[model samples]
Target: MKTSMAKQKKSKSLLRREWVKSMVQNRYLYLLMLPAIIYLVMISYRAMYGILLAFKDYNPKLGIMGSEWIGLKHFKNMFTDPYFRHVLLNTILISFGRIIFTFPFAIIIAIAFNELKQRHLKKTLQTIYTFPHFLSWVIVSGVIFNFLDYTGPVNSMVAAFGGERKVFLGDKKLITPILYITDIWKESGWKSIIYLAAITGINSELYEAAELDGAGRWGKIWHVTLPCIRGTILVMLTMRVGQVLNAGFDQIFNMSNTVVQSTIDILDTYVYRITFQQTPDFSYSTAVGLFKSVIGFTMVILVNKLSKKMEGTGILD
Candidate 1:
């Protein structure tokens, strides 16, 4: 027993020494990662303590730690609230709508950009397309209001064209589609950068081989380009699936008004309204946020698993 214990102790000490040596060897790499590490620790990990507020009756005077524990009370209320159910349904619908409509635009745009032969023209077009992503939702909303408001250019054009003026923003049926369109317009170009990078990394030999096989541009794209970027697409898709619950809070909040509020009231907006617009219920709001997080986490795990099963690899892997 003594001999075995000594061997174990010596092994542990040797492993520690090796780990220290490896760390010293990669000191520069660690230095490069320091800012991200600090951000995760200070901004993300530190905020995790607030999650406890979901199970507590939070009071400003009492503080997070001092608050009375009311385990599952807020969760029970959330489950029973009809408005919450409606909000959840809306969130799911809008999120799926974006996945269906907005998600593919990035891939398509990336492919189109890759096909452009003129470098200067491609760069100019890419700059024009990606410029919208930098504009905040507040600015975008103002532009939308200017274009879609009553007596705006669109309405004026409709009037001139012998058609009735339309309240585009106020129309519930139009709002969801508008959201998808705006999201695609603003984000698709910037998001395409990833796929473009993936495409750049693809071996040119594959394309040459396809060309030799009498494969044209379309054939090369369908076979070589797409197959090469399939992993990146799957990884991106898995990450997007993880965010299934987040249906653009900033965009929805800025664009939504009383007329279309009910139709676009997602979980984030619902929490915001309950917490700030009406009577503040910190515990309930926290509970809602927690629920959203749990659902998102579950979605990520499930999708990652599905990706692994289908492709023999996953985001987590």
Candidate 2:
């Protein structure tokens, strides 16, 4: 027993000495990594110090540290506010609408792109599709205004056909579908890149065997292609679930009008309104932001667990 104990201690000490020697030898490499570590500390953790404002009755005169703590006050107000249900409903509807409507479109488009035999045509199509994603929401909004406004080309076409000019952006009934379709237009192509990459990673031999076994194009897509890319789908869905509350702030802010506010206003816009439209109550805004973050974190955890249960794997894995 005494001899065994001595050997264990000697082995641990040797390992520790080796680790120390390796680190010292690579000290310059460690030094090279310091800037990124410092940037992360500055950008990610430095702002965490301000999170204390969430629990405080912050006053500009008193400062964040000087303010009185008021636990759950903002949270309670947030949940119980009159517009809470509306904003929550819109946020949820818009998020799930994208999942149901836009997500499948991206998948289909990816599969369609993967089927293209002509490389030049495929590359051109991909470039055309992805170009829209590079455009800023501000610029896209301007283009949308140009295309959909009362005097725009769409309404002109309607007028030519002797049909009534439609309100595309502001009508409550039209907003949900408009939001989803526009999202599909702007992001579906770009989002398909992940699926395309996943498709590429799939073994070509699987497809060759399927072809020999009398599987048709559609059959192969349904049976082989989809199953292979299903993990990527699950991971993307998990991420989308995590972002359920993050309704596109820039798009909503730019495209929403007074008439459509009740239809499209979301949690992010609510935070902005509180901060800028109302009194600049730092505590209140921070509380709202913190609440959003907590919900998103909880959602990611829950969905990741659910994915593990159903698929025997998870986004984290």
Instruction: Give per-residue CA lDDT, model 1, range 1-317, as digits (tens).
Output: 99999999999999999999999999999999999999999999889889999999999999999999999999999989999999999999999899999999999999999999999999999999999999999999999999888989999999999999989989989999999998998899999999999999999999999999999999999999999999889888888878989999999999999999999999999999999989899889999999999999999899989888878987786
TM-scores of all predicted structures: 0.86, 0.88
Model 2 TM-score on a 0 to 1 scale: 0.88
Give one digit per residue, the lDDT tens place, for model 2 in 1-317. 99999999999999999999999999999999999999889988888888999999998888878999999898898788878768888888887887888889889999999999999999999998999999988998888889999989999999999999988897899987887888888889999999999999999999999999999999899889999999889888888988898878988888888998878888899888879988787788898899888888899889989888878888777
Measured with C-alpha atoms, the lDDT of residue 143 in candidate 2 is 88
After superposition, candidate 1 runs with Cα above 4 Å error: 2-43, 308-317
lDDT of each: 0.94, 0.89
Query: What range of 10 consecutive residues in model 1 has the weakest lDDT sum?
Result: 308-317
Estimate candidate 2's alpha-carbon lDDT, on a 0 to 1 scale.
Answer: 0.89
